[model samples]
Structures are given as C-alpha cells and as structure tokens.
Target: MVEIVPYENCYLSGIVDMILSIQRDEFQIDITLDDQPDLLDIPAFYQKGSGNFWMALKGSEVIGTVSLLDIGGGKAALRKMFVKQSFRGAQRGVAGCLLKTLLTWSASIGISDVYLGTTTAFLAAHRFYEKNGFLEILETELPPSFPKMSVDTKFYRQMIKPSYVLPKRADLEGKK
Candidate 1:
C-alpha cells in the first residue's frame, strides 16, 4: 500500500534520491541538486505559510513527491512532482495521489492558484497537468515569484477553491 504524507526530516534522503533518480536516469535531465537549493532545505523553502511538501511511500520506500510553494497574493507554485516510473499509471496511482495531496493542502490553506513549470521534454508531465485541470499558459503569464528552472519551457496553472479533504485510512480507522 502507498501512503501519502507530509515531508519529515528523516525522509529527506529518500525524497532527494527519488527525484534525482527520475530526473537523471529516467528523464535524462542534466541538472544537479547543487543547482536546486530548495531540494537541500525543503523545510526552509517549502514549509512556510501555505507551502508544504508531500511524499508517496510504499513500505519504507519513497516513490513520489510533490510540493506547493506559497508565493503570496493567494498564489502558490507547484514543484518537484515526480513518481518512480515503476509506480506510475492508473494501476499504481502514485502521481495522482501525490497531486491530490498537494491540491487538498492548497485548498485548506486558502491558496487560490497553483502554478508549475516543466521542461518541454516532459511530455507526459504536460499531459498529466492538463488532465488534472491545469491549463497550459505562456511563460510570460507566470508570476514574478514563480521559480523558473533553466530547462523549464512549459508552464501550467490551476485555479483552486476550497474543497473536501478525503479522509485517510487512519482517519477512517480512528487512528491518530
């Protein structure tokens, strides 16, 4: 079973490994963690105001990640959305679960908009965002605070409203 939960200090290494594996080995993106400071200090970068990071864990393995960065003015930026190729697709639903986790958190925290930037090479990513109600937008449309990566050429946004947060299995079972 896969569980979606918030980022914890102990899970940092797992999160970093998951992202780097996907970006380097799967996507062949020539980027290093050094160039992306946020991944190094997730709490300082993402755990403020309406921001948060989430991971999809199966057993003790981190298989997916998603982040919502509070950018002020009722807006947030989506970042670090990656799922291990083996756990992707409808059967596993790791990506969907991670996205739903972030969107649910965004709604709870009054985030009105969520934006994301991806590389043109991420064709599946573009489709995933679009399927999840994110509209494709020009680079010029992104907010000034949106962190644009060097390889990012495609951008997307999703307007959000407060909605129901599905209860977790623990919640249903009356576990803390």
Candidate 2:
C-alpha cells in the first residue's frame, strides 16, 4: 500500500534517492547539467514555511515526492514531482494521490492557482500533467536556471478552480 506523508527526518534520504535516481535513470538527454537541487536545500525552504513538501512511500521505501512553494498569498508553485520506475505500474496511483493531497492542502490554505515549468522532452510528464487537468501555456523565455543547451522546452499552468477534479485513489485502480 502507498502512503503519503509529510517530509520528516527519516524520509529525507529516500527523497534524495528518488531524485538522484530520476536524474540518473530518467534524465539521459542532457549530461552537461544536473537538474536536481541539493537535498539539504529542501529542508531550508520547508523550514521557512515558504513551501510544503511530501513523500510517497510503500512500506519503508519512498517511491515518489512532490512539493508546493508558496509564491504569495493565494498562490503557490509546483515543483519536484517524481516516481521511481520500479514502483511504476499499477501502483503508480501514488503519484495522483500525492498531487491530490497537495492540491487539497493548498486550497485549504487559500492557494488560488499553481504554476510549474517543465521540458517538452518529458512528453510523459506533459501528458501526466494534462491528464491531471493542467493546461499548457506559452512561455517565451526559459527560466535562467534551466539549461540553455536544449532548445526544446514548455511551460504549463493550472488554475485551482473549484471545478478541478482531484483524482481519487480509485481512478488509478487497475492501471498499470
């Protein structure tokens, strides 16, 4: 069973491992730069209450994570969402659960909308966001930190409207 929990002491390493695994296994297109932030940096932001973060776990192992950085009152930005490949098939509902939990928590705190930036090369990621009701928005200039080596990229946004359907755990039932 998959469990979603707040980022706490023991889970930090698992989160780092999940991110490094994504950087190593999933991000092969670019070797000139590392896409992940330092693990230690995560807690500083969370500790400042500038953001909220969570981890998805099966038993004692963390398989995924997602975070929301509060941009301001009624606004937050989505960041660092990833799921491990070994845990990918039918059990992948954890990703949706993590997202729903974050959205619900954001709404409770008056976050009106969430924004995120991602690469066009991550087609599966784009599709995942679209399936979760995110709309693709044109971003003319890439973020300064984003690698300049790649010409292909995209940005997306999702308004946290009441009509948005936060996927239920059942939605991923039987999906492999």
Candidate 3:
C-alpha cells in the first residue's frame, strides 16, 4: 500500500533522490539538484503560508511528490509534480494521489485558482492535466506573481469551485 502524507524532515533526502532520478534519469532532463534550490529546503520554500509539499511513500521509499506554492491572494502555483516511472499510469495511481492531495489542500485554504508550468517533453502530463480539468493556458494568462521557470513552455490552470469536493474515484479514485 502507498501512503500520502505531508512533507517530513526525515524524508528530505528520499524526496530529493526520487525526484532527481525521475527528472534526470527517466525523463532525460539535463538538470541537477543545483538547478532546483527548493529541494534543498522543502520546509522553508513550501511549508510556509498556505503552501505545502507532499510525498507518496511505499514503506520508507519515496515514490512521488507534488507541491502547492501560494503565490498570494488565494492563488497558487503547482510545482514539483513527479512520479516514479514504474509507479506511473492509471493502474498505479501515484500521480493522481499526489494531485488529489494538493487539490484537497487548496480547497481547504480557499485557493481559487491553481496554475502550473510544464515542459513540452511531458506529453503524458498534458493529457493528464486535461483529463483532470486543467485547461491549457498561455504564459500571459498567468498571474503576475506566478513563478515561471525557464523550461516551462506549456502552462495549465484549474479553477477550484467554492463547494469543492474531494473528487470521486474518477477525479482520483483508487489512488494511493
């Protein structure tokens, strides 16, 4: 079984290793930990204000991650979404679980819009975002405070309704 939980100090190394491996090894993205300073201090970067990070763990092993960084004024930027290659796809549901957890937290904190930036290389991610109600958006559509990464050519936005419900199995059923 898998467990989805808030970021803990003990899992810092696990989270960094898992994400770096998937980004560099699995996706062949020519990036390093130096390029992602957030990984070095998850609590300082994401755990303040309305933002937070989560981990998908199977036993003590980190399998996936997602984070919501509150840009301010009930808006947020979704970041650091990565799942292990072997644990991906609908059957595995690791990605969905991480997303569900983030969305649920967003709703709880009165977050109105969740925005994300991704690279063109993640075609599967584009489809997944669309399936989950995130519409493709232009860079200009982003909020002034939205943190746009250099590699982020594709962007998406998902609006959270006032009466948000933790999505049914379809939104992320059988996840985790």
- Candidate number of the best lDDT: 3
Across 1-176, the per-residue lDDT of candidate 3 in tens digits comes to: 99999999999898899888878887788888999998999999999999999999999999999999999999999999988888989999999999999998888879999999999999999999999999999999999999998789999999987554567887586676
lDDT of each: 0.90, 0.71, 0.92
Q: Per-residue lDDT for 17-136 in model 1, tens only?
A: 888888888889999999889998999999998899898999989989999999999999999999888898878889999999898888887889999999988888888899999999
Candidate 3 clashing pairs?
169-173
Backbone clash numbers for all candidates listed: 0, 0, 1
- Show model 2 residue runs off by greater than 4 Å: 29-38, 89-91, 140-152, 162-176
What's the distance in Å from true for residue 102, model 1? 0.9
- For all predicted structures, in order, the TM-scores are 0.90, 0.76, 0.90
What does candidate 2's lDDT look like per residue over 48-92, in tens digits?
A: 444788888889998888888776656667777788877654345
Worst 10 residues of 2 by lDDT: 142-151
Model 2, CA-based lDDT = 0.71
